[model samples]
Target: MQIIVRAYEQSCAGVLVDEVTVEADVSKTGQQSTFSVALNTPDEDGDGYVAILGNGKGGTDCNDNKNQRGALMSPGNLEVCDTIDNNCNQQIDEGLDKKWYLDEDGDGVPRGPDFISRCSKPEGNYMEYPDGQQFDCRDTGADAAKMFPGNSEVCDGIDNDCNAVVDDGFPTLGETCNAECGGVRVCAADGLSVVCSQEPGRYYHPDRDGDGQGASGSLPTLKCGTEPADPGTVSNDDDCDDADPATCEGLAEVCDAIDNNCDGVVDNATPACGGTLKNVASHYVNLGGDDWKTVSVAANGSVWVAGHDGKLALRRPGAQKFESFSHYNSAPQAPTDGSPVLNNNNCGDHDWNVSWVNANGVVFLGGQTGWIGIHTGAANFTCVPGQMPTSQDAITGMIGFETGGVTTIYVGDTSGRLTRWRPSAPFAEQFTVVNNSDFAYYGLHALSPDFVLAVGNSVTGSVQKFVSYDIDSQNPVTPPTEHVANPNNISGNVRSVWMGSATSACAVGDNAAVWRWDGGTGWSKVVGPTGVTGRFSGVVMRNDTQTQLIGQCYIVGGDGTSRAKVHRLTPYGWAKPLDIQSATANVALNDLAITPTGEIWIAGEDGRVFHYPEP
Candidate 1:
């Protein structure tokens, strides 16, 4: 229920001096009510308002609940800016004479209205209408030497300009700094500034043999300066001996039975011991046409190159130049004279497109016409008889391995079919292992004689997803197991795969997508280099656990600008771009291989070749 209370007062002259009416709802306890409007009354117990009892003067009850002697209050009675509702208008220090001190030292700035409110400036350091020039943020009291704006900055370990930057003109004590010497810089123990000193985190090992290089293998030091010592040092542990500067990393592999280049291989430069790759020269072979597709280098120094128009070139051991051959003339045509012309299935002349060379000097070259030619010698190549089923033709990838004294070659086609061929005298057809309609195999790499990895795109998904298949020797006749790999949370077709071992492999493809295969984790994508998102057609990884060059992976392909790009992966991430040419030439590196003797060779379109380590 609602309740109303009215209060009235009259003056001695018989006039209505004060009148107030309040309305409220009765509380559930029946002892109090909540007032809707309270006028000029102070709630003492806060148990809802009682009434507005005036002093018999017009609006004289500034605080109705207070004693009658305390009700005489007005705005004109306040004399200073003290924190109090002196006029009973619920406002403190309203319309009072005051002065804003020039609080330069911030010591005189009042925290609240409880300050000395004077009409004129104070006698002691305080002024009126203050600005930043008069305010000192750091000032504490009068005894403290006054620091204010417009003061000249000097390196006396104080903010002279009031800018808050202390002693920024020189390096402060205990700060990490750099010096001209190869060693790192540390704040001196006794001095006021930093000095050149050694820190365990960063130490430099200098080359004393004057070889323009530094010895590695010493505990690494994080020196900030780029200047080298008297005989400089490099930032790696590849040096076999720091005392002998001539025995540093990347040295020439001479025939002195020593493991030069610190690769743990002795006398490996010659082709007899495996082959030594050279970056000193670029040999371009012209086939009177364009389009060079792929190249493969065997362990024994046999280089086999293949491309469009059924072109094949071979560079055998001790040969200075590549010998070119044409497969167009050998492809079987329609039997015009009933003499059994090649059933090329309309695949253009001698298009022996992809080539693979095994360790036994055996090469298998295939092309679009379902033709796979076997080459035992360096010069002659023989095409296997019979054509594949029309849907299982158009070879995309081929690899071979020898097991139980027999060499078996596996071929992957565009329709996701894998076929096995036994190169026994007549190259007999073994069996078709898999024919999955959901995925298209683009590349294959043999991890061992027992396992092979097939990589390509999964067409059944909403987006083309990069996937792989593991073909084991025990189940070579059945469909291989499939595994999907996606890099950067997106899917793209994988173009190539290189298996360093059964436990380690790397695959590359569209949008610079890179994935690594591990025996423990299956397959995982690698975060590519920043700012170089482009299609990658080639990748080679070298963990080299036995040598000094461990933990290095190399990737080569085209970038967003269509330029040939080379990136090396350290433990941190992809190193900076190692490219000199721009996109003008379209230098897309299609394939790359690292030789046993520490030589890197990369080739692509326009017959372009790049040798790394730039020796």
Candidate 2:
């Protein structure tokens, strides 16, 4: 409610004429809550607004006391780019803010850092905010035409693509580049890139048989290109026989007369032999094969059994029976029973003793009556001409050529004569007597390419001795001198010898007298088994993986009871008889062979060939 108090003039009738009024708002509840009041007044300035007495200024004008401007700043006034509230209430140039740069070159891009905020794009390549963010470093220099990021780079070491790195995408000076076939290219001397050239030669190994093994020689086919188009050819030559695919290094040695394993050695040394004896054979019936004297396994696993009857028998590998060779002293003819045929000329009647040959598997035989022959395949044998003169000079032992391509066959005779024969030349006498006595040399061993040892007994003294000769000497070997001194005048005759190393050699003799030779200590007698009544005919040293167990002297001979006796010499001395076959009259083991597979083979009287373990 509005309450007004008026000043009344005390005049004659209290008519309340021309009175001044004062007013205020009053609450009816008397609780002093919020209240407002206004005095009714007229609109001044014709803007439909006014202020009343008893109240603060209230109007639609910034200055209510004034009448000209209505609101503090009216809407729809033109905005300007000023750092002030020019339109009045509060803000500065908000919506009118525009970033513009000076593109003095007019290339549609602007120069560095020289820009301003404007309402719109100015004339002549000037851009606003987004398009103006691009800053050009040069505006009037030689690079100005290429100032844009899309411009290609020149060799001036300047920024390209507007990125930081200089001369980045261009070829680096002196950097090397390679091609497919060993060709090389480098950044050029003139500071440009060079073409890939000067390719290397292409060498290929021929494998016409597709065996995956290359040829044997060092020769290779050279060309200039990528690999040759032939898949059968490679870059290595190692295959000995490239005409047969099954003759590679990975192929196992089959019972064929070929180097199937490509190991340079023949199939005789293959690893397929079981460790123990197997498939023992005693005799060949109905086949003119009897009393086999010497035996050898050929590259094809064919066992060549030489009989005392002057006939040769061939047992095919893995076969149970043997067949006599068709022709031993006549024209070559195929055997009827699919046996190996032979042709021999002037190989006099003699008992075969030793048989061995060179790495090429050429067969050589030595025997009684000064007889020595060479087997030239297809069942053909030719007596080596100009052999020792008399039957008393029978070749007892034979060893193949050693060192160099010398091809010297060292032979020993029962008369103690030592001879050296080159397969290409006639026999040359080496020594007529060894150890200052005529000892019947029974066995020969090559300790090294230059060193050879001959073992036998001197009939004059009835004692055994070994003679060493250096066949490689410039001068004739200082006439075979005694290497071992018989301290006790050992009465046994050494029958066989084998060398494990240049300085490590072992010799076995009558009554199992084992003698060891060390370069530093010379030869000393080591006591062997006392049970051996007969002389050891053959001995071998096993140096394969079983060296810990088998690296000893394996001596084969017989006891007086006519049973085969095999003994071994261990570190502590000779062990008891390692193997002793049942006693059979006239059954004596004459030789023993150790195969590459660690198997032991024994050949003896009565055409006996026993594989270890009887497998």
Candidate 3:
């Protein structure tokens, strides 16, 4: 360890100004101390003044007893040593020899006889004369009496004791004064009691609250009603129910409108109708008792049911019963059993697939005879001016489009041929084959306008493919582009495809197979519940975040039946399908639609048209 000391003031001759290194060597017998010195200045020759630099002592030989006292000399006065009592008064080097003053009783004054000697041994102990005489010094106890008389002993130049002089020196013994004046003092022999002069206008707490009454004297006294009372023990008599402090005066009483406490209000004062799952109405429409095959909702919220009997019956929203229209009757008729033909001159003797264009309230039905039927909030149906392909290859799917004042219909036949029908042109000019390829049985279900997605057993193998045509192209008779293709082994005959948002779409197929499309990320398979296997019949995108796939399954019964199931697409993944109750265990869902308010409309086999409100 290295220690360094710096001095601010210069010392007299023989004072050292050097750096020294002290080292200690320890051995078995003892430790030897050695110091290496470096001197900064030299001593003058023949001047009796030697430089003490590099020397621990002030140039005094350590072996000389005469020079031992020189080691105690003050740095400034090199000639005088503070170790001897030069001006003796029985104490060695007293007075200024110590840095501090002697305050025997801590009276802020030097209890002196001003002896010129060294400080007392053991430090902090003071030497005093027997007579209690003191050296009068500035700011010391000597000056305290001369500057302030009859005042309390403050460090300021004022003696508050009033002993006919300021700070008449501190008392020799601990004493108590009757007043601030240094008179009528009571001395304690053991030097314990001490009472200084009382401050002016401030008494010794004669009475409580300092009212100066009740045993009012120099001593302190307690007054009545001054001390705080025990809690809850007050004489005010203002609180009636002291136990419950809040139920005091000025509290109002609350009524019985769900307000338990009398706070003048009710609990949950306002109520709102929270959106919750209400009742779901599922009904099956029987078409002329012909074992109702399918149900669908038209654009104008009219419920239509078609079955093997070839009768098309309709029911509007909130209607109690269904109504049937004659082949081309201008007026709607009551529910009948006859094979009601559509307004379009097409014979009504076949199972039909139906889709609605809500914008114009048009109902497009395709089955044995493909036709475009119109119902503008009226009971009558008018046919558009074009005839479909032929009865041999019935229209399996039809999509209507009216963009930029050009109305056209895209029809997909069972032979996987997509045809465009423009009503205003001649028969030969109106029907044009868009895509007539080897894609077999492609039209079980179609998506929309320009996109005709088909899934069935192809000549090559069981394949799922989508053909998209640009309707605005000048050559509208050209083949569509095949954008998606799934190997038959992986995707076994996709039966239903539902597109939502432009990005989220789902295709379901046989064996509980489901595939999801997320725009740029093509398609990925989705896992289904274990042991549940069947093909999906209808798929509808309810919203951007939810999709519903309906199909038949053998999960519940050993035998296969048309079972309706709904699945919701969440952030994590697609949820398991929840079964929707159907009138019959084997009711096959054919089509699904979601109203503007998110109500789910399902058209299924056996005229099962069910309406499920959004959950």
Candidate 4:
């Protein structure tokens, strides 16, 4: 209830103090307390609007006293972008504001992420934001034509539209370009500024055999994705065989004498005795008359041939004729030094049964009566004093290597003696006989300085023996053990042994008895080709640092009269004997050597030296 007082006639207590008092009871009312008062007035700002809110009187202005503020800046005014709630909607320029983006290039497509939502666009380097999030990938430039969406991209080092790829839209963008190496055009490494340049390429290794398995730990061939039509290649490099399809990764491993599992070990499941036999074609050079006992390949591509009656010949690589030297008997020595006369002087007249060539191409010819002849270049031989510790004996087999300028030689004599001879030792101690018995070492090879493999005959028992000596090693010395199968069952001497590595070797001997060293003390028989029986005096394998080799193993021997036989080990047993030339019919191939240059050198009777290169 409201009360009004008119002070026209009877006034209240002091005329200027017009006041009233009101009261109400609230003992048990539902509400705790409720009281409010509003002074209703009209035209407070003189705009003809009341100041009371919901007093049943007309009031529309939130700020009734609009005179203190702007005259027309009220609920009845228009809203503008001045950063203030001018129209009193509890918002500053709500419907009148716009979001501006950094469009420095003025390309219409602005930067997507960075923007300013305000009443107006920024002062500089900005524009009204586009419909969607548009990125000015390169926002610094002012090329509206080229730096906008749907524009042709050039090699101007910028991403006009943020297509995620910095270098796209080029017609030949991924063409293979050859610079320092072959590579295709990919995104720049930084993935920032676009350019004609690209990062490095993926690598693909070679698959020369078209087996889809490349050489293990292989080298990259042509750059990836840019290979030729027939450019056989493999992604994972894992192959130890060349043409054998049964070898490589994911292939079944068997006892095929190859690393079928590509684990770098030759058939670890079982000891292999044969391999993929190689077919070879041989060419021979006849030195004539004296029987050539040994042939060696020198490091400088020269071939040294030593033989009976103290004969030695040097055939430079690719030379058709031999420069022969003589000692005991008068062998033809054509002087290349223009000495006007041939060299007919006696240089140690006896049979030179073995020869070894050092790294410097110096050939040491071990001869009968404990003699050794050293030949350097010319048609002259420097005879060393007798090297035997006892009576005169012919040096049967010899192998040597040099270390720290000191040459260490191992000599095998016909009298079943094996000695280590150093050129620097005293005469009495020069030939330190390592083994002296009735066990003749026909061939001795050193897999390392500490590992020596010897194949020979046990003269006392007349049986075959394969011995390995781990000299001065953690393992004790292994004495020679005779392998006596039967009176005629591979019981002949193991004449020659060639080590493929410290763990693998091949040996052959009389009676066509072929054997494979089990990388240990045991020897397994590689039964000879059926219906063919003869002697295998020499054996050689392609040198490989790894135990799993992919090349060939050759075993040679013959009858003393006709038909020199050359056999190769096969995955089954033995390949048929290589067809021998008619000229080499009477020449029984005694020994063969494969030089580091991949040349096969074979020597035999009547001063014959053959160079056999397999196809």
**Preferred candidate (lDDT higher): 1 or 4:** 4
Worst 10 residues of 1 by lDDT: 338-347
Tens-place lDDT per residue, model 4, 1-615, is 444432211123211212233454556759756654443344456543334355334344445566665343444557787766556556667677377777777666676676687876679877775566546666664544356666555544455455656446654455675444544554555543333343345466666556687756667654434434335666657766534444677766664344566676654654233222122221222435667778888777787777776666666665544555555444344445422333443345567777788876778767786777677656454445354664267676788878778777777766766667766667665556666667777887775556677777767776787666655523322354443332334567778888876666788787778777656667787777666566777777766332233344677785532136556674333433444444444557777777774455677776466654421
Weakest ten-residue segment in model 4 by summed lDDT:
8-17
lDDT against the true structure, per candidate, is 0.54, 0.57, 0.44, 0.60
lDDT of 2 at 320: 53
Stretches of model 4 off by over 4 angstroms after superposition: 1-288, 331-346, 379-381, 473-489, 544-551, 560-562, 570-572, 613-615
Model 4 earns a TM-score of 0.49
How would the candidate models be sorted by lDDT, starting from the highest?
4, 2, 1, 3
TM-score of each: 0.50, 0.48, 0.45, 0.49
Indicate the residue-level lDDT of 481 in model 4.
Answer: 47
How displaced is residue 232 in candidate 4, in Å? Answer: 24
Going through the candidates in the order shown, the clash numbers are: 14, 18, 28, 3
Selected candidate, larger lDDT, 3 vs 4: 4
The best candidate in terms of lDDT = 4
Report lDDT (Cα) of residue 162, candidate 4: 57
Candidate 2's C-alpha runs over 4 A off are: 1-279, 282-289, 296-303, 314-323, 326-348, 380-386, 389-392, 426-437, 559-562, 576-586
lDDT of candidate 1 over 185-224, digit per residue (tens)? 4444542455656433335555444444445555554554
